[model samples]
Target: MAQWNPSEEYIENTRLYKWMQKLGYSEYDLFHQQSINDVEWFWRRVEKELGIPWLNHYDRVLDVEKGIQWPKWYVNGKLNAYELALGQWAKDPIMTQKEALIWEGEDGEVRRYTFSSLATEVNKVAAGLKKLDVKRGDVVALYMPMIPETIMALMAVSKIGAIFTPVFSGYGQEAIATRIAASRAKLVITVDSSQRKGKEIMLKDELDKALLNCPEVESVVVVRRTKTKAVQLKEKHIAWEELLSHQPCLEIEPMNSDEPLMLLYTSGTTGKPKGTVHTHSGFPIKAGFDAGICMDLKRQDTLFWYTDMGWMMGPFLVYGGWVNGATIMLYEGSPDFPNADRLWQLIDRYHISHLGISPTLIRSLMRHGDNWLTQKLSSLRVIASTGEPWNDDAWYWLFEKVGKEKIPIFNYTGGTEIAGGILGNVLVRPIKVSMFNAALPGMSAYVADCWGNQMENQVGELVLTKPWVGMTNGFWEQPKRYLKTYWSRWPNMWIHGDWAITDEDGYWKITGRSDDIINVAGKRVGPSEVETILASHHYVHEAGAIGIPDHRKGDALICFAVLQESIEMTNTVKETLLDFLSVKLGKSLRPNDIHFISDLPKTKNGKVMRRLIKNAYLHLKLGDISSIENPNVLDEIAQLKRPGQKNL
Candidate 1:
């Protein structure tokens, strides 16, 4: 059953419908087929429709001479991402004064920036970078929080044709040091301090510790976010105010379309984190297309996605909102801080229209009841979600209590490597609960087995047969490793490392990561299936399911459950859940054991790290846990293992 079906008025009013009409197509399937079959023509039309002001038009839309993995897009085109996203908007006399960016701090502080003012700040920072001898192609690390300066720094680097990589604010010394060293960054920008839930974090101190071993870093720029203490000026240090005090240079670098724009590093299950490279025209344009045409982020509308700069959604918010000329809203605080209503208050206060979040956040907020939903979210039109799979209970709660069953939830799924989404719920189609209505146009997405045979109605690896504009050129100077990670899985096919299933109705749902699937006896099942069943019970707040080594069954399902607040774990509750799972998932699929805990390990973005949970329980070596939000939970999970269980 569909949760949201577009009305006639809604369908006709969308940018997608308008674009389809321009292309003389009324049906989505035909348009999507044309998009993938003739991608060059489709992409050329996309840029023109988006009104991209190219300094020099490309002679060719795409050149696949180097093969699909290394296809050069927009051959010979000259444009800067900063220009498309901000400079052009500011040049418009009327839109110059409109709110381009709005920010709110946890301490009740608020700031607003107009297009013209933001451009000026960005130009000043660009000049400062030049003064510090940061040349084109230079890598600069942004170890700052989700503040206005972070956006300024991002645009500034792009304006000068330099690259910037954002580090998560919650990262410790080693994590920050690792990225800076890996990128060989020339300069680093950070905040003096930041506040989260009334606690001060010394961000500069962490950077200082990281810079100790990052020999390539020549300078540091510090923003006074909390103004906790005056930064001591060293040879390599400069104040944010000082950087802004420089003469504003209004020169926009005319960069080649394929020039490096940003290097976003994403952690893997094993080995080192991969540096996914995104080009100037690549990331911004794809992000704009997804936000504008797919999600309907119109001009003057406020777009807000709760995330940090380190995350992919962070850049998505900046470039996506800016390219569409929409107002981007940032909240530099915990989502549920002084009260559970903080996110709701922000939406109502800012009149945000397009809101993005994770299913984990919705699950967390459901614990507080409906009292926090006091604000009338009349301005909100759509809700978008990514990061992890959604459970039926949490999905229904958000759709009913928050949206009143009127607004649509656009389930988006992709990765940093793809720049934007491969599968999403476009407004043109009816949206099913917790599933994608369509694979995003221009992406040749399908579910297939290891050998590339297409499959339906069963779980299979999500693979892309052709390259799209936003596809990463390759990992930063590690072509062999990049090939081994994605392309090596099957010849020429990009294995996205996710397990997906499509129903006869054409709706798609991501089960879980391929590595997270558990095989018990001869049946393989995604952890989300079992977790969803566990979470459906009234006593269980959330759950993490993993497979432990079994002597006879090959793999036995083990579940760790977090109980609702004020609820105590008992044998009765455990038996009730286990029996309920057997009824829902069948006798063979039921969990072998269930343990109660206070919390599950998660990332700052609210994604539960099940790999860490399994490693902790098995007393195995946990690798690359820098993204973990609560490390202490691992210790708690480790203590729950029975005495007889050996390390797998």
Candidate 2:
């Protein structure tokens, strides 16, 4: 890792130093110290400084006696998140006519919408929802792609005090049906189809299949994206254009600041997904603040984040960028579409200031070499990464190629539950390879062992000791499950299930998941699910699955199976296993490779030694093997390797 001396010029010109000085902070004081000592004062100051509108003010800013389970924020305030994001800005001359959304398709088509224009569309949509008998607190499902209409639908749902659930367009019909049924959504917003990598996907067809299972869905609004001929609408189905054409653009509705605004589902390993609830005031405020300071986004910046509406990053990008009055560049296509340089071309042509990506995408680009990045992106200022832990190779390549060793790569790590990042790199900090410089202000995070003991410079589970404003209120309709998953592990602390270790220099590195979970290409999966599918095969007796660290994907799934005595393992068998698993567990969950073993290592209690298998495959140092009853099984498996094998 290369370290550069702090430049006085950079320090003076940085966004953090300038904001701190403007906000009446002394130059010698640290941000974290000031924020911790006056937590309420800090948030109250942010609410006022950011010009957030409130219909009524609260007597108290924060009440902590509830132990994060019941954080009484803005005790008496009345305001709607929609009013703050669009209405308040609609009244201001500085932002009314400014371009709020810039939509670019893979086929080189583009569309632009101003704040006033978007507000009109949102108002009409809100009116249409009301006409359809949708009431406050009703759940609305958004099954659209990454387009401007998606943002309008979200704002419309919030305007009417209805909670919105945005599902990813890439999901299959079964996945979509499960979420819609769980949410009990009354209305669904979708498009006819979307183009990805020059191929058309029938989004409306999938929505129809999902709606068949969701009888509660009374109305369906379709947005026409492609010129696919004609389909007669059902009794409850309506064209989006028809709804907006007759309705009048009206004023924004005001509600309590703490009112529920959206429900986003977290991909759980077992059982159904948990619906995480977020409020309007806290989410946008926190997202905007973090975007401005941590990401160093400015008014003149053009920001781009590659994500789907189903993911939290989708809403985060909109709220964070638009609140700062920055131009948000969006694309509804694959990064490698048309050619490998498609993303680079957009950055070059649009002169994007801040570019956000995932480590998996960067590694794929690195394999093609850095020729696309040879051209100087003079307007580029910051590069951000999230979704999964970054590797040393990808981090170094970003700094060298995309940044030309000039711009800093801000690494952010957080979840959908919290609207903002807990740990992020700041502009003032020195850039180290694949590590967060420090935890965000007003957040207290530390690594703890299994017994709830805090440890330094050792691998442990990441836990949060205090509650932050951006934390989710609770899981919708599953408060007990939420408590069991997060707070039950440690009292009043959030156990994030991630294995992390902090160095003496205060840089945090993520090792892997504490639970037996797998992250393949930034998608979360459970080992048990894959193992269950493998065991169903006729030739497989028993199987164990584990994730191995890979440079391309953050991790790759590796399966070890003890075949039945009647079957003989061969190339044909390997091919058959691959095909079966791909169909059963989806392509993303398919194992990278399969290994055949005669006997599985187990303890006297009959617990399989999954750790030993992972260690042997990666050639890493075995941590503890005394618990294994037959450790010799590992040696036998290691010796029965095929030709050209370097390590087991």
Candidate 3:
């Protein structure tokens, strides 16, 4: 039986259909092939079709003479990303339509802003930034919670051609200081205080603490979201309302196609982070392209992803939704807050069409029972997943329980460097359990063995053969580091460092991070493979797998898992889990350590810090864990007894 065959209504309504008709292509595969095969043709046609507004046309389609790493996009073109985002909606329809951006705070406060109102606020904030001496090419640090002001700050920074550097709201003083110092942020924007889980967090205090280490910061813009007066105001403090009231100027400036729009520092395990630079033409365009094509986002839809301002999805949501003239929703707290059904309530209230989440969240939410997902999600046309690869049990739960087996579970994998998705599920095809239907359009992706040979029906490294607009120009002032990180792995191909496999039917699935692969007694296994089996049990909520050094085998597998809130670890439960693991993963490869812990350390975004767990298990000093949501969770693993480690 077909799992999710596209109906005629679905097919005709897709943006893919409109493109096919316009380009004279009969099939989706052919269109995808052309998108990567002839970049000049695909991009030129897409730019015109999507109505991307440009102040000046490009002199050439692309120039790769320098190398693929420095490939130029929209060569010689002069345009601002915001203008392109509001392109055809520059005036009438957006204002007349009513819905645009909606915000929900953890305190039960709701606010709705139409396109006209949002545009005015954006212009006002941009004007305010200019008054603070934040001009073109200035680097500003955006450190705030997932408040509505954060969104405004992003546009304001982009409006004047300044490069915005974002830090996760959960970061401590050390994490915040390191990023500001690395980016050399000239101006900083933060809130006075904010509430999370009913506690007011003094962000101004945190900012002041971070500033003590970095003398480069000249001024600070504080938003009084919580109206806290716990700390005295410094001379550099500027109130959000006072500055924007004057409205210096709303004029948009033209930027070079290759100029840096943002300097995002991807989290590192040691030392300072490597800043990934994104251009005005590159990041926004790719987000719009993938959002419109792969996710099938329409202007009438509201897209919401559970994420933070520091993560790539934050900017992806703004640029992607706006570029396509769609409504975007912002939520300020945990999805499971207030109740387990918080995520469902947001969907029902906003009439969200495209719902995006992580498998990790789904795994946690599943313990709440399927009754929480009974909300009338008729408006939800697409359900998407990202971050980590989905375990089979979690994937099926999302498919059958939430989607009612009707909506497609669109899973895709990409990183900050790509700007958007590389491999993703599409609407025009049938999606299988725990698999993606295709590589996103304009991305030439394939699974290759260690020697770089393309593999069939086997697991290997995922590589991209062709470049797209979204690929980062290079790391900020670290061209050598950039080359070593991606380009050095394969001669010219972009090594994405994901272990992936393809089935005989051509469906693809990412097993795990290539570096996270575990080898037990010569036979290799992905952590996802073992973690899925453990999570499939009724008692387990979430699991993380790591490779450990062994005497006989090259490496051994060690698993850490969280038990369901209601279930306690007993001798019987342990024996049951051990027996199940032996059966599913084979006796030879069964984990030596299956420690049931209280929680797992994860980034602000929902990826488990497996490397941190490994370091903790081996009694190594845990490095800067400031970005982790639960930093102390590592102590659970640190207390475990390792073969050669002392009991602290």
> In terms of TM-score, which candidate is strongest?
2
Check candidate 3 and list the clashing pairs.
Answer: none
Which parts of model 2 are misplaced by more than 4 Å? 1-6, 22-29, 229-235, 526-546, 558-648
For model 2, give the 10-residue run with minimal summed lDDT: 637-646
Predicted candidate 2 versus true structure: per-residue lDDT over 133-246, tens digit per residue:
778899999998898889888988888888899987876565677778889899998998988878888888878876788998988998888866465577889898877875
As for TM-score, the candidate ahead, 1 or 2, is 2
The lDDT of each candidate is: 0.87, 0.79, 0.80
1 or 3, which is superior by TM-score?
1
RMSD of each: 11.1, 3.8, 11.1
Estimate the TM-score for candidate 1.
Answer: 0.82
lDDT of 1 by residue, 96-147 (tens): 9999999999998999999999998899999999999888999999999899
Candidate 1 residue 463 C-alpha distance from true site, Å: 0.3
Top lDDT prediction, candidate number? 1
What TM-scores do the predictions have? Answer: 0.82, 0.88, 0.81
Q: What is the descending TM-score order? A: 2, 1, 3
lDDT-superior candidate, 2 or 3: 3
